[model samples]
Structure formats: structure tokens, C-alpha cells
Target: MSTRLDELVQELGQADRQERIELLIDLARELPPLPDRLAGSRDESHRVPECQSPVFLFVEPAESGRIRLYADAPAEAPTVRGFVALLVAGLDGATPAEVANLPDDILDRSGVREILGMQRISGLYGILRRLRALAAQLPQPESPAKMPADTPSADPPSAASSDPSTAAASTPDPEALIAALRTVTDPELHVNVIDLGLVYGIQTQGHEVHVEMTLTSPACPAGPQMIRDAVAALEKVEGVTKAHVKLVMNPPWSPDRMTDAARDELGIF
Candidate 1:
């Protein structure tokens, strides 16, 4: 039998883009408020730092030996709120192992990526990460009776851990981060920021990446979105836990900075 989350992912995968958005909005409306006990405790400590929206999560063991996940996100951020609600509905009653064993790419698998901006997607990833980390801290199930029907007793190791090459690639590297950023494009130009000479520098420390880049112009309207996209792209890399993007304008962007490919595409002589 498929879990509620598995069915939900299938539904999202089957829906058209517009219908998916509507479904997400409806799910957002379904997120219940934090219970009175946890209501007063939704402070900075419980907040998910990656989300731009004010989102908080709490996990507690249920009387039935399952775990309950409670989340709170403002009504204004429907996308994030919807994802939180979806998780709660799907996994709230699941055993710790089930929640901990969730696939890391559940967001992409659901096909919701099409409707979400890169920044929002990154934030949602953070929420999942936070949830899983909290789940890992819970006590493990001692017997088969504790496992839910949705979760199988025998489980395979995650690909990242099972594959030698994949395990090695999980650490953030300059090349990987750069390659990831190459996917972000300037909305107006349809040219990747990398080829457009928008990215100035990239630094990596452990799982974090720090970037310094400039825009076409100081007043470029797409600056903010571009920055967010760049950050999202970097963080999406297997090992990157955080991405910091800095905007620098001291050296103004000029056509001279564009890569040959970008110039050729733009028909610049």
C-alpha cells in the first residue's frame, strides 16, 4: 500500500501546471495551527532559517509510538505553508525510520518544481532537511509492530551512501558549485549568468559556498531574482548546506565581460 505522501506525489506528478498550483494552494489552506502547548514556543529557536517565510517545525513522539510533526508558516507564503502541510499529512503518523528514510529528492519527484521559483524550492528543501534532522533524533522502532504499513521493514542504503562515486561527490567542490550556477540564467537575456560574466567569485568552506557577483546594471530589475536563483542553484549541489551570494557593483558589467558563447548568442560582434 502506498503512503499518503506517495499518493500525493503521484497526484502532483499527474496534474497540469496550473492544477498543481491550485492543489498546492488548497493544501496550504489545510495546514493546522500549532497546538496551544507549542503555539507559544514557535520562536527563533524553532524557526527554519532557510525559509524566507516565517516557518517553524516541532516533532514529538506520539502515544502510539509514531512521531507527529507540527509546522507553522504564515498564510502569506502559501507555497512553503503548503509543503509543510503536505509533509505533516503524509508523515505525521509514520515511524521515525520512515520519516528518516524519506528520499532527499522528494520535491523534484513530486513534479512541484515546475511551479516553484528556485528560491522557494531551496527554502522548501531546507524545511525537509530540518524535518529529517529532527526525525533522526527520535528513538528508533524496536520491532516490526512499530513500523507502519507504508514503511517496509527491509530498506536499502541511500544511493549517496551506497555508491562510492556518489559518496565522494557529496562534498561540495568548486567545479560542482560552478557547474550548478551555470544553470541560472538572466531572465531578460536568456543567457546563463556564468556565460554572461555575471559571476565574479566562488568560495567554498566545508558545505557552504560564498559567491560574489555583479549585475548588468546597478538598477537592473532582475538583480534580486538572479541572486536568489544563483543561491538556489549552488545549494542544490549534493553537499552544499548553505550558499551566500554577494552583489558587487564597483566594477560595472559591460558587453566586454560576456563569454564568447554569450556574445555569439546575443549577436554581439
Candidate 2:
């Protein structure tokens, strides 16, 4: 581990859940403003698609073989912004080899994983993955024997139906759709949103499917990603040609919305 990362882990290790959250907010506030060149640019290439927040990042080799990271996350998404800030503080100024050798479970050692949730932690992993990829582009010493386990696979498992007979079916199976939706998880909570009671309703007309859902918070950084995942999950269902997700905040979300299983996992007795 980098010295900075080790220090951070030790600092955060002493805090309780709520204190960890406060520290994250403080880190978010301390995040440096983006450089003018990359700020507000619409270059899709820099965007981290895995993040639900509109986060964009880039890494470049700096003087003395150091690496510099630049990132932008919306102010509304403090959790995401804080995470970005954490990465910047931890890995900035580190050598390429140090970055490339970062352990996949680095975040797990931070002592804030439970408070940050699985989704946010997962997005943090995505940021690290991008950083490593950028670092790999520059000339370096012999690569590590093993890559980080959390690095996303190039070939995602196919969700398409294997049976050709079911491929053209026009009716979307409600059960199958539900099952597919179940596959989409809340990265932070490590629980399916369905079990969290995020899905308010699901409907299908012809081959188009519509889903109504809400997030744990209106300002959830993972909101957009969750919505996209929901749509993608639905589209993978047999007979669903299109998928639409409507995010609702009228009723809001509360612990009561969670299913017994979710509550059990979260120890919400």
C-alpha cells in the first residue's frame, strides 16, 4: 500500500459509521477544482460509465515518473465526489508502478466500506481500474504476475436467450422480468434494489417495458447508473425490445420500504 493510503486507512479505521460519512463529506469539500481544459467538456471518452454520477476522469504521467489524476463529479453527489477526492489524495504523486500494483481489496481496508455501501465502493474500484489502465499505457517495468481481481472483464456474460424459439416471443414474461431486475444490485448496499423496495411498478405494452422506481435518496450518486442498469436488465428480458425507467421521489424512500431480507442483511431490526 502507498504511504498515503496506509495513513488514510488508519485514520478512517478509528471512526464509527456516521463519523466516516462526515469524513467523506469533508474530503468532498476539499477536492480541488478541475483544471480549465477538462472542465465542462462533453467528451464521452473521459466519462466513467460505471458510475451513476456524471463522473469524468483522466490520468497522465507527470514529472519525475509520477502520475496525476483528474476527475469531476457533481456537487449534488457528495458521496461520489468524496470518493473521487479520496482517490486523488491517495494516489496522486505516486509512481506508475505503485498505482499499477494497488491491491483490488484496497478499499476493503479503508474501514468505510460498510458506510460507503457496495455500489459506491464498486464505483471507486471503477475509478482505480481506469487509473490502472491509463498507467499501463505509459512505459513501465515488468507487469505484475496477476491483475486486480475487481477489474471488470472485457467480455460480460451474455443475457440473451439461448433458445431461438423464445427469441421472437412478443410477450414479456413478468416473472422473467422480475428475475432480471433482481440481477441488478445496489453497489453500496450489495443488495438487489428489488429487495430494497426500489421498484414501485413494472409494466409492458407490446415489446416496450416501463419501470417506476426510486432511490434511497434523491441525491444518490448511483441513481442514474441504477436507472440505466434497470433499463438494460429489462431489455435483456425475452420479448422486451425497449425499456424505460421513471424515477419517482414523491413518496421518497425509507427503511420501511425495504423487504425483510434486506433488513436482515443490513441488520435493521
Worst 10 contiguous positions by lDDT, candidate 1: 144-153
Note the residue pairs that clash in candidate 1.
none
The whole-model lDDT of each prediction reads: 0.73, 0.69
lDDT of model 1, residue 224: 94
Tens-digit lDDT string for candidate 1 (128-224): 7567656655666653222123222233334554456754656676678778888999999999888887775565545556677789889999999
How many Å off is the CA of 71 in candidate 1? 0.8
TM-score of 1: 0.52
lDDT by residue for model 2 (107-212), tens:
6666657777766676666666656655545555443322223323343322343344544465688778888888989888988987887875565545656676
> Would you estimate the TM-scores of all the predictions?
0.52, 0.50
**Local lDDT at 211 for model 1:** 76
**Residue 116 accuracy (lDDT) in model 2:** 72
Q: Provide C-alpha RMSD values for all models, in order.
A: 16.9, 15.2
lDDT of 1 at 35: 94
